[model samples]
Target: MTLDGLPERGSWKGLRAENGKCQFLSWKNDFKPDGRFTITFFRDAQQTQPIQTEHGTWSAANGKNELRTDGVRMPDVYTYKLTDVDTVRYVSLASDPSGDCQEDYDFIERRIRG
Candidate 1:
């Protein structure tokens, strides 16, 4: 299973450019043909204690994308743009009325292996 060339089941490791934090991680996730996915991200040196884990589903439409997640403690819905097959981008204004919380999870993840 793959999503825009990303392996469905594998671990992606990288460093956060903003802070140079060692972002080691693992994930057991997959994407369906309907453009929906289930993912679990594990960060090695996460600043947020208890770590942050998210489970969400993303759907691609004409030029927009929507991500809805029913997380363990906090659930959120994020809408982003399907820029291309390799990138997905989303943003929310601080004053947005959505129940979603703001987080700084800025990083890039590349395929490693299962």
Candidate 2:
């Protein structure tokens, strides 16, 4: 299921411990074809308890195998692999020295469809 192109323009959702430690449960990312992206963090798996939202620009490089997100903080980079047409796994390339454990985990996101 390896894919070599930009991710589909839409919403993608995944459930994981916030910062790989907290009880917060879900992360939803919306990617637009125009390079704009938004990430919503939820405290529940159902995505009803949104805690925070971040906006940024995104780009794909390294033959479309890498995804970079530029936000208010630092630019985060990830190397991604497609698990299926509707699912992808992203490994963070940046390490967190604050011991957040975010880099210790892999994110698996499934495309959200209407």
Off by over 4 Å in 2: 1-3, 17-23, 63-71, 95-103
Q: Per-residue error at 25 for model 1, in Å?
A: 7.2
lDDT of 1 by residue, 1-100 (tens): 5443333333433333434333444443444456455655544435233334555665544433345665433333333443444443444222223433
TM-score of each: 0.39, 0.76
TM-score, prediction 1: 0.39
Cα error, residue 54 of model 1, in Å, equals: 4.2
Q: Model 2, 70: alpha-carbon shift in Å? A: 6.5
Q: Per-residue CA lDDT of candidate 2, range 47-99, in tens?
A: 89898887767777663333344433456667787777788888677642432
Which window of 10 residues has the lowest lDDT sum in candidate 1?
Answer: 92-101
Per-candidate clashes come to 0, 0
- lDDT (C-alpha, whole model) for all candidates: 0.42, 0.68
Location of the lowest summed lDDT over 10 successive residues in candidate 2: 63-72
